[model samples]
Target: MVMSLGQGLWMAINAIYAVTVVHLTPGQLGVSVSVAAAIVLVCSIPLGHLADRTGPRTVQMWSFLASAPLTAALLFVSGFWTYLVVVSAQAIAYRAGRSARKAMIAGLILPADRVSVLAYVRAASNVSVSIGACLAGLVLAAGSRLGYQGAVLFTAVAFLLTGALTAREPRVPPVPATAGSALAVLRDGPFLTFTILDGLLTTHALLLDVVLPLWVLRRTDAPRWMSAIILVVNTVLVVGTQTKAARGTDTPAAAARASLQGAGCVAVACVVFAMSDEAALVPACLLLVSGALAHALGEVRQAAGSWAIAFDLAPDHAQGQYQGTHAMGADLGKMFAPAVFTWLVLEHGALGWIVLAVGFAALGTAMPAVVSRGVRMRSGSDPVISTG
Candidate 1:
């Protein structure tokens, strides 16, 4: 929650701060962010390997400490190049910590409780991010460059505190590096396949964050406020029900089943969203709400299931590297989502949404077989997929 809150505070105002205070153009900002994301994507595996060798707790703490100053450096960025350097450095520090953090969770928690614990953390994160965003709104309402600067400073302090807290966390012993290079993950065909499939599943996030709001405004009669309303509803529902949705996904098969259910909800949401385009205002609003609810439900199920698959499939000795490799899929999905979703939903409209829906459903349907086959190939026993 602390980490997410800090992220929320910065994210809510960063673009505006860049435009108004740092005087960067939208295109420059986009390029800088994309570049930063690319850096994270390229660096994650190496950093994860470091964590595997040196211990996740140590790497996580140091990464947080490193990020504090880099985040604060945003205040001094005046040009596009300076902003890019600062933001990219900050993203490198941030992304470097991610796999270690996941490894820490896996190291400390029993597998049976992993999904529930992750759900709880995610719920808290949603609530805290909402609070942080509200606070950022107040800061922006103060309407000055100094106010934005203060927001950046607050984020830096938050990172410092989080780093301090992490430093004091109970340490988990490092796993000794094996004979092969960390890049050996590249040679693991089944794991590579799983990661690609996982990445595809993450496209649903783009559907919610990018496609839905644009579709509502450009194609439907629903009021603009409905978008904000839908976001709030999704947040509230996720916070309230994620733990419940996480139940019963204790095995690979069960996790795959949950993912399939999530895909079905997402598909239904697309159909409902399409109907809103031609409906009366009141009916459109209702359909929009219904779609948002379905999307949120799908998000909850997918998150739970994905966590299970990722944690369970990872080799015990190479957890950090494996987690890092899994994370790459998400980064890749998010990087491509804007262009892909825009072309599909905005350019082609209802038929495009249906096509996406079918695609998602097909992927979900294939997941069980894919997971089963991959696990069998890896372990030579179907029941090993159920192991914690």
Candidate 2:
């Protein structure tokens, strides 16, 4: 619940910032987000390893404390470079703590159903995001920097409190580290493919970050409040759908195939979104919401496949490092997508929509094959081709 509150707070602030600063110019905002994500990716492996060696609680506290000022200061920044630095600082702290959190979650769960539990966590996150987007819309309507800044400050407070809550929870034993294992983990074929495909999926998410706001502002006649309404719609759909989709997964192969189909749905949504205009706003929003629901489904399957495979693949004590590597793939994709999408939007107006559609379609088509190989190599089974 605390994590949900915190995420909502941050996302609300992010939505405001997206309109006011973050998505101001596709190039600058994209670069800032990309830089921040890159910093997180760079810091994740080391932080995860450290968390495994030492308890994650102290690290989480320091990270939150360090990040608060940077997030607060974003309101005062007028230039892109300052935004990049400050946001990147926040990202580093956030991702370090995030890696620790993911590793810690794995530690808390029974191995037999870890994937399902992760799906629940994902649903919690989606629900939180929905709430946050609704609140963010209210804040954005106020059109005050203070409201925006305050929302982010609230997020920082949630981080601090999360640290406190985590600290109170008894610490777990450290996963023992081994020498030269990072390289070895990277060399493992299934793990590498999982990382790559997951990275591509992250790019699909960036489609929401880049296109949705632009779509809302440009194509719809709805009031500014509609943006948040749409976000609410998207988040609610995800939270509602994820449980059923996740429960449908009875096997690892089933999980991977479901995820791939979800990706295909996102591709179809992108195509529908690209063709939308004022006349098509209602259907477009529906399509967009549908895409979000599908993405959530894919995310659950992806999480399940990746976690089950990674847990089986890693030696008991090496889970932290394994988790960190996979997370970095997501961070890398988050970093790359914004810049590329920004350029696409700038270079071609509506044409950019076609580009994203093609990109998503290609990704969806390729995902099953990749996951099949990954499942076979990691779990020694042919992955299912049908979604549950």
Candidate 3:
């Protein structure tokens, strides 16, 4: 909740703040954000290794501590370089702790209940983000530099409080490293393939975040306010239904099936969204709402399924490194989402949406087979195990 609130407060105004206060051009802002993601991508593995060596709790606490000051330092950035440095540092600190935090969750929950717990966390995060974004909206309305600074400061304090709270959580014992090097995760073929597939599946999220808004603005006749409503619908649905979606994703096979179902929902949503292109405003609004709800359901199912697969496949002793490796998929997806969606969906129009839907279905269909193969291989001679 703390993390989501902080993120929401800053994200609501980050682009405007950069342009008006930091004086960065749109292109520069884009480049700097990309650079920050790249930094996280490059550092994820090493930080995960660090988490494995020490413990997730320790690494997570320190990461929050490091991130708080860097986030606050954003208030002082004067130029593009300074902005890049501060943003990049904050990104690094945040990403560095992600795997450890995930590993900590894995350690805390039963395997059968991980998805449910994750769903609750995700739901809570959405609620908190909504609150934060609404608060930030009030601040943004004030239109003062001091208001923006206050938002940043609020984020900084949130991080500080989070770090302090994290420090107080019960500690989990670290698994002793069995391998000589952290790079061992790179050599795990099945896990690597899983990561790639996970990355592909994650593109759906990118579609919702980047493609949907652009499509609504450029392709549909719906009013601008509908975009905000679509997002609200998605958030509300996730908050209300995520735990229910995660109910039966306990086993690997069940999770794989859930993912396939999720893909189907996403495909249906895409087709529904496509129909809005030339429709009347009422029809377009209804279709958009329907699509958003479907997409939200897909998001919940995919997230629940992915958690099970990820936790099931990761080696117990190296959960941090494996989870970190899994995170690379999200990083890569975010990095390429804009260019990929522009070329594949936006520029091509409605046909592009169909193509993406088909692609999602294909990926979803293949996931079960891939997971089965990994399970078979593990059961044969490799015997991958999770102590958590």
Candidate 4:
């Protein structure tokens, strides 16, 4: 929640600060963000290795500490290169912290409780982000440069505070290095396959946030405010129903099944959203709301399922590195989502939506098989390097 608070505060103004305040072209901003993601893909495994070499708690805390200064450096970003460098550094820190945090969860939380607890954390993050966004909204309302700087400073402090809190956590000592290369997780074929499928399903996020708004504005007769309403509904559903979705998903098999179910929900929602394109305003609104509901439910369930699968399937000692590799797959999907959706959905119109729906459904249908394969490989050979 503390991490998400900073996310909210910064997200409320990060783009505005970059584009408006620092006077960067949208193209430059996009390039910088994309570059940072590329950097993360390359850097995540080594940093996660650091977590396993030192300690997850130590890595997590220092990542946050490192991020605070980088985030605050935004105040001095006067040009494209400076802005790019700052954001890239900050992204690496943030991604490293995420991997370490997942390792911490794996170390501390019982397998049976991890998904449920994560559900609660995600739900709380929503509420905290809303509160933080509201606070930042006040500064945006005032429209002063100093106010923007102050809001950013608050985000920096939030990063610092999160680090301090992480430092207070009971130490989970590092796992000793295993034989072979640091990139062993990369050599695990079944695990890599699982990550790719999981990453595809994770594109559900961009489906809602990026593609839906385009669908609403250009293809549908839904009111312009529908996007905001859809997001609100999503948040409320996530807060209310996440625990329920996470229920009974204690094992990788159960989690995999849950993921398929979630994917089906999102695919159905996509079809529903496509049908909204030419409807009357009332019908379009109803369709949009319904689609958003299904999408949000799928979002939470997929999240819960992925967390469990990623944890249970990874070797205990290398959770940090595995988590980093897992995250890189998801990041790959995110990086490509906009372009993929634009070509598939926006360009071809309704047929594109069906194609997308089919893709998501296929990703879902394949989850069980992929997950079972990973399990079999792990149990048979311990293909990935492990201490045991």
Top-lDDT structure, candidate number:
4
Query: What's the candidate order when arranged by decreasing TM-score?
Result: 2, 3, 4, 1
TM-score for candidate 2: 0.86
User: Quick one: RMSD of model 1?
Assistant: 4.2
- How well is each residue in 324-382 modelled by candidate 2, as lDDT tens digits? 77788778887778778756654564577677767766765675677567656555464
Clashes of each: 0, 0, 0, 0
Measured with C-alpha atoms, the lDDT of residue 379 in candidate 3 is: 76
Which regions of candidate 2 deviate over 4 angstroms? 12-24, 178-182, 248-251, 278-312, 345-350, 375-388
Per TM-score, the best of the predicted structures is 2
lDDT of 3: 0.78
In candidate 1, residue 294 scores what lDDT? 91
Candidate 4: tens digits of C-alpha lDDT, residues 1-388: 7877777656555655666678876456556666777788888889888888888999999999998899899999999999989988998999989999888888888867877888898888877765666665566557689988887788889899999888799888888775335687887787788888998799887665556655665678875446556666777788888889898678778899989989998998888887886778899999999998989888888888898898888777788888998988877775666566755666677788788889889999999988887787778755553323
**Model 4: ten consecutive residues of lowest lDDT:** 379-388
> By TM-score, how accurate is candidate 3?
0.84
Q: What are the per-residue Cα lDDT tens digits for candidate 3 across 262-338? A: 98888888888877876678898999999888888888898888888998988767878889989887777657654
What TM-score does each of the candidates earn? 0.82, 0.86, 0.84, 0.83
Q: Distance (Å) between predicted and true CA of 164, model 3?
A: 1.9
Off by over 4 Å in 1: 10-34, 73-87, 136-151, 207-230, 271-289, 346-352, 381-388
Steric clash pairs (candidate 2): none
Clashing pairs in 4: none
Report lDDT (Cα) of residue 154, candidate 4.
85
Per-model CA lDDT versus the true structure: 0.77, 0.64, 0.78, 0.79
Ranking by lDDT: 4, 3, 1, 2
